[model samples]
Target: MRLAALQEDEYALLESDCLFHLRLFEAAAMPVVEPVLQRCLVHSQRFKILNTEPDSRVLLETANRHVAIVDAVKSGDAAALETALSHHISTIVDFGPDVLPLNAKS
Candidate 1:
């Protein structure tokens, strides 16, 4: 992702980002969620691309976010892992409904 970001390759960065998360989703041992997640990630890909600005630091920011996840997973603590996952996801949710048109509140 970082390499793709540095190279300014949007497609590669998005692909790498999605693949990274897909592996984590697969790790959860839920077969049903894999396809669902793939669809969501792919569906959101275009919006993400559209929303990006040339100056945005997507990869660096994403990599920094992943550090907490990696550290938590490495610690082998379930509670810590859960917290890490929650916090990581919260970053996405923090954008609020405005950022995701489909999620907009009535």
Candidate 2:
């Protein structure tokens, strides 16, 4: 399924990114990282939808941040990785609620 469609599937959306990270980590011979990252991603998705629809800027930012974080990890830059992760988490904490509209009940 396409990203837009997958983004709508609550169960699949975060899982998709987690799986991607898993593959990347595995290729880097760091498969052990997947479980922790996957767990965090899964838990975070429940409250913060990374692909919260219709916001191209949010999506772009998320993608860019992901790339930066991955690069930091790949390069074994502990300080850069920490900084990248801090910024990513701050963005999510600050903007996550703005992206998710209130659900209407019948």
Candidate 3:
């Protein structure tokens, strides 16, 4: 359809990707952050080219934190998971609201 519609669909898909990764962490043993982390890595490059070097570094650190979180989850280390999650949220906040998609309620 329209470009806006396409972007909406893309945003929804990415949100679903995060949700699926959370579900996997909740119900299974596998760490499903790979897909989301890979996307964030690409976003870092995009942010850098867009002259948002700070946000790009934040995104890269967030991706690295995801790897650590995944390892903590796989090892069943709840304390590590909590700390990692906190750092991850802080990194995203530093990345700022404009860098992320704001999907409207459907």
Candidate of highest lDDT: 1
Q: List the residue pairs that clash in candidate 2.
A: none
Two-way TM-score contest, 1 vs 2, winner:
1
On TM-score, the candidate that comes out on top is: 1
Worst 10 residues of 2 by lDDT: 1-10
What's the TM for model 2?
0.48
Candidates ranked by lDDT, best first? 1, 2, 3
Candidate 3: where are CA atoms >4 Å away?
A: 1-21, 24-62, 95-106
Q: How far is candidate 2 from the true structure (C-alpha RMSD, Å)?
A: 9.7
lDDT of 1: 0.74
Q: Note the clash tally of each candidate.
A: 0, 0, 0
Candidates arranged by TM-score, highest first: 1, 2, 3
Tens digit per residue, CA lDDT, model 2, 28-83 = 57567767766776666655564366454544444455777778889999899889
